[model samples]
Target: MSDLATLGRRIRHFRTAAGLTLEELGREVDVAQSQLSLIENGKREPRLTLLGAIASRLGVTVADLLDESAPSPRAALEIELERAQSAAAYRELGLPEVRATRSMTDEVLRALVGLHRELDRRARLAIATPEEARRANTRQRLRMQQVDNYLPDIEDLAEADVAAAGHGGGALTHRTVSVMAERLGLSIVHVADLPHSARCVLDLENGRIYIPPASIPGGHGLRSLALQAMAHLRLGHGEPADYEDFLRQRQDASYYAAACLMPQGAAVAFLERAKRERDIAIEDFRDAFGVTHEAAALRFTNLATARLDIPVHFVRVAGDGAVVRAYENDGLPLPVDATHATEGQIVCRHWSARRAFARSTRTTEYFQYTDTPAGTFFEATQTGTAESDEFSITLGVPYAQSRWFRGRESGHREVSRCPDLTCCRRPDADVAARWEGRAWASARVHAHIFSPLPQGTYPGVDDRELYDFLESHASAPEE
Candidate 1:
């Protein structure tokens, strides 16, 4: 069917669903009944203004009327091609406009389909700028919360694999590489130049895992990276074909690696033992597991609620107060904009995640008590430097759960009304009392807030760049 027919059918369906007759809808949209009947019967295409009016009257979007999902696959492809060709970029490329027609040849349709596919792929692979990365992180954070930071199927598979490997007793050591390699029948290769930001890569076809020489010197980091690669094999995860799939696959692999390093049952037992001492020290946990503090804190979030019976929140923030990563099982309110809180937003200065940056020693731990709209929370935070960038990591519990943590005894405390101008921690009062007029700090331009990805593309991407990317990576190896 033609686009007009598909749109007309949708309009009719929604009009009937709203219990509106042709005359009634015409009256609501200020159009004649005869014209509405002509449009609904596909005899005439409605103007944009008329279409919008009809959609509003029917309580639907114009896009809903044109939704390609309701049409046949070929029709949907044609509709997509029509939409793509309308873009200025496609016109600039001097690409031929492919119209939707019932008698269009299969060869022509196939060519159009290939062009559309290439354009889409390019949009997906374009390099993300810093702002784009931040926005993507923000969206991914919200998505993670929607699923409650749990993937039961992946977790079950990891747990079963760990049990099978019989490497569950003590902290995961460098020896795990040998054991897993022997058990899974895989080869491990270390190279000097793998890829930037890539800890390890798995060649599924050859059953070889490649690691960077730099990451191997750090025993814990190496073990974690290697185990994460092993996870792809153990859990039977295929190579990710898209950006979203890549993120999900990485997360699953990371979770699997953590599970392997700190098996669920053993981790729970350790937390139970720590609870008896009323002091849950992330550094101690890290020492016990030969993992980084951040890794230990993330592991704590995984088992805190189920095993320790304490809901917790974890955040990692950069020195500049930007949230790098965050997760929470507890209902403790973290400062968020219209979207769910993730990376990119500048956290309130009153929060421990930001306050920890002010400590005299970067290595020292800092603690604070805060009261948010949700409830009071006690947070323990510590700072570390990696490659010249300082980051702060925080682990917080509800006020009631604070008693079970070592940081609970700290004298530091503050009440926060964050994301508000009149927040108690704001220096507005002090400045007003003294040098309000003499001092002025220009409002910092938040480029990330305005640098969102273009519509119909992944977060922080331009359509043209995406098209180019897709064209280049079309035949890239799965690994």
Candidate 2:
């Protein structure tokens, strides 16, 4: 669907270029001048026949009037200014709307648009304060736990889409993914100049999904990116209204992508068989689905409790032992701040996620039983490289449930009195005493802590850059 405002602007532009008044055009098109004026002002949408008539009189085609790109730089600024002024944030200011007229210079329009952009950016940034984000994360995590992290609706959708693409099981192919997109009237365009802040840009106007030409490093593949992009459309997502909405949409897309990569029906069947043999393992699951260990670990938690009646916990820890991501409903005591956000929190040093980093071998999964304040958990941690970062993926369950999984017989064990000042946080008495008076160490601060969320229509994306990319490719021949 065309943006009614932009379409109206285009019509007005063409009519003025042809040296015709609204009255003149209306008469030529056999429409009332008042109705034509309403269309020109973007107050009303014109019927198709009337639109065709208007286009014909203006010496332009329907396509020309409906083009997604701005007809001119001035026109683009006008449109942006109008949109910004009409926004809820702007309206809440209780200031009079400034109409862009012939007297308004392009510079003034640009300044107004820039000011609105900044105002909107700051508004969004304020909503994403560290405290708010942490709370939102905690809330989202709690909700996921309530549902056992299973999205049956999304699972059904993925199953249907995969079946429509002729998938017969095993790893989904790039060709099959393309087929899925094509069936939905979307084209997957691999471009070298994808927006730096975005994993993939979905050009709804052009019906194109732009992704990086090269495969993404780590477990992040182009197929996954493409599927995630398509998931937005499949899931009926719109511009997020707030930080919580943004997080939910992202979570949904990622979950949908994982579902596509490993369809629920097939994956559950495979897991059931493995459980029957008392040989359920992450590595085997990873190999079976041709996914990374992290993907397999995360996916296992999605189904473990829901389908197999076995509760589980999953965590990805950075080399420095900070929790990157975590999910659990199995009573595993994950490290969290006051906000209950697990990310960036330091995991217990004795836990398998952190301990796996000390191992000399990355060839096999490291299994360990960790005794924590909450309870004992049997975990299988695997170290892997994502670009330059070496992280560990840990999947674990309560000690009682460990019998259903492989590596339950591993003898490695450790104890963690986490959340206690004496556990791992305090240095050894002799070492602390010697270093306290003589040692000086600089702390490495994470800049992200101080930075605001990215400023754009989409979080962490440059709207202008995305628009420019779409414009440049709008008329290009489809590959």
Candidate number achieving the greatest lDDT relative to the actual structure: 2
Q: In candidate 1, what residue range of length 10 has the lowest lDDT sum?
A: 452-461
Cα lDDT listed for each candidate = 0.73, 0.88
Provide TM-scores for the models.
0.65, 0.77
lDDT of 1 by residue, 1-479 (tens): 35675676678778988998999999888889998887875568888888888888889898888774644555555556666777776788886876667699767887887877787667655645545544556666667656666556766776676667666577765665556766787666666555443456665555666676744464777777788888877767764544555566677789888877777777777888889989788888878877889999998887787667788899998887888788887776666655454566677778888877777876657889988877889999989987897899999989999988887888888777776767744567766789867777988765756754433333333445545443443445424
TM-score of 2: 0.77
Candidate 1, residue 155: Cα displacement in angstroms equals 3.4
How much is 369 displaced in model 2, in angstroms?
A: 0.7
Mind giving the per-residue lDDT tens digits that candidate 2 earns over 105-202? 88888899899878876787576766787798789999999999999999999999999999998888888888989988898888888767787888
Clashing pairs in 1: 121-470, 122-466, 122-467, 122-470, 123-466, 123-467, 453-460
Worst 10 residues of 2 by lDDT: 212-221
